[model samples]
Target: MQTTPEHDERMAKMTFASVYPHYVSKVERKGRTKEELHAVIFWLTGFDDQALQRLIDEKATFQDFFDQSNLNANAHLITGVICGYRIEEISNPLTQKVRYLDKLVDELAKGRKMEKILRA
Candidate 1:
């Protein structure tokens, strides 16, 4: 099966490490902390601190990164509009998953509590 090029460009082929700094910056600039950002990603992906660092250092592609993830069951609880797309309504499965992570990080940057962001 083939995935969309738009999806490939938007996120599929992007390296997690390449985009990670921006995530840290976005949250820290908003008065949040890197720990919170890490926590969000960890919660979503089931990666511990060591595993996440390893993935980043390896420059894993978004597809590779997610392929290694044991996505949390509660991830389905993440919903709402992001970047003009309704999270739950995204047609392409990979795009929807990527957007789900993006939406969580966005919420963290916007100052939502970690527990709430984790859907706890």
Candidate 2:
């Protein structure tokens, strides 16, 4: 069946509105700072003032914002899987303390095995 452009537009708008609510609330509430809130929203929905204001009214959390965002579910799932793997790969107190990417690279250059480098 052929779908009209109007039908497609309506469907897209509905989807965006439905999904937007969840993210808005989370970022509004749980984001401790303006930048933090903006960053999360920017990552999720680009930047829309009306949507952002709605989220502020509702208050939101990081997970909530992520759950509601327009990001593809399968993509999010795949990313979650990869993140889990990365976390497992780098699950060491010493490695956790390395806040900078450069520090991580430097540690990697020490000629140490993955396990040893992560531990250090």
Candidate that would win on lDDT: 1
**Candidate 1: regions farther than 4 A off:** 1-5, 8-10
Query: Per-residue lDDT of 70-109 in model 2, one digit per residue for the tens?
Result: 5422222111112123322333322221111222233333
Best by TM-score: 1
Tell me which residue pairs clash in candidate 2.
Answer: 24-55, 25-59, 25-60, 26-60, 26-61, 27-60, 29-59, 29-60
Q: Weakest 10 consecutive residues, lDDT, candidate 2?
A: 74-83
| Residue 46 lDDT, candidate 2, scale 0-100 | 48
Determine which window of 10 residues in candidate 1 has minimal summed lDDT. 1-10
TM-score of 2: 0.25
- Candidate 2 C-alpha error for residue 54, in Å: 1.2
lDDT of 1 at 14: 87
Clash tally for model 1: 0
Count clashing residue pairs in model 2: 8
So what's the TM-score on candidate 1? 0.91
Candidate 2 off by > 4 Å: 1-40, 72-120
